[model samples]
Target: MVDQASRMQPTKSTSPTPLKVVAATDLLARVQRLRDSVARRAYEIFESQGRTFGRDLENWLQAESEFLHPVHVDVAESDDGLTVRAEVPGFRGENLMVGVEARRLTIAGKREAEEERRNEKTIYREPCSDQILRVIELPAEVVAGKAAATLRDGVLELKMPKAAPAKKIIPIGPNMA
Candidate 1:
């Protein structure tokens, strides 16, 4: 016999996971793949509609919606930097990737569904997988090398410090007439 209260207690070792930061080039490549998928789906939609020309935008939007899940994000700016918060429920930090550039930020994640069997016959099974991608343009430039990200409680937070403004230097020389 075990104590029910002790068995139900949550573990204290669980902590926020640090997200992996990838290069901007990698992010762009992933974006390109998503674009290709959307384009292919859009073409299929067009054929389904008898190759309609006037509804190209509609077909593209429908394709995007079908292939991607919308992510809710909030970006806040301070005098020194920017902070971004995104809702990514049911996603573990290991399943997510983040990329930051001077003027852009990208977040992408993919989670595969797991199956369990206890020697019981299955009645119905539905295929399920989750994927999300979002790219944001910053209002000000930032130091990409110093960016940091963490995921906890289904929320992802990113902190990026702003880049210093370029300084103009004037050469000191004798005045020329």
Candidate 2:
């Protein structure tokens, strides 16, 4: 009689034994991981691009705002007069206009650069911008007609004499009537 083992025929396994199984699973996982990484990279790129765009837009807006808005100033007063001091570098009396209306004083003028100086490219131009428009409002009563301004040594100074306060007259009930 022939033994059962001798009659059996060997057949190859449909799937890989052990080593190939792990490799297949690893490959699938790696592919999925690569897809996730690509997605993340795309998101990162988009976010950074958005930030850059926003920063550029903000810079432009800031410049526009500054151009539209009025220039900065320092307004102060003294006992003798309403002294308005403005920071106007490279300015002279000719470049500033100070007008006092009632208690409000307005300073507006453009600093015109000498044609000869604009052409010369210097290392440092103090307040390269030669244009200025300044308006100052007084806190107290000011003598508009007597107001005078002097722009000297980059400081626009306005001398406004304060008006004397009017006395208040209090009226009482007429003789207890």
RMSD of each: 17.2, 25.3
lDDT per residue as tens, model 1, 56-132: 99778867975676788999999999999999999999999999999999888878888988989999988667767
Cand. 2 TM to true fold: 0.46
Q: Cα miss at 168, model 1 (Å)? A: 3.6
Candidate 2 local lDDT, 64-106, one digit each (tens)? 3334455666666777677777777766676667677877766
Cα error of candidate 1 at position 50, Å: 29
RMSD of 2: 25.3
The lDDT of model 1 is 0.90
Which has the greatest lDDT?
1
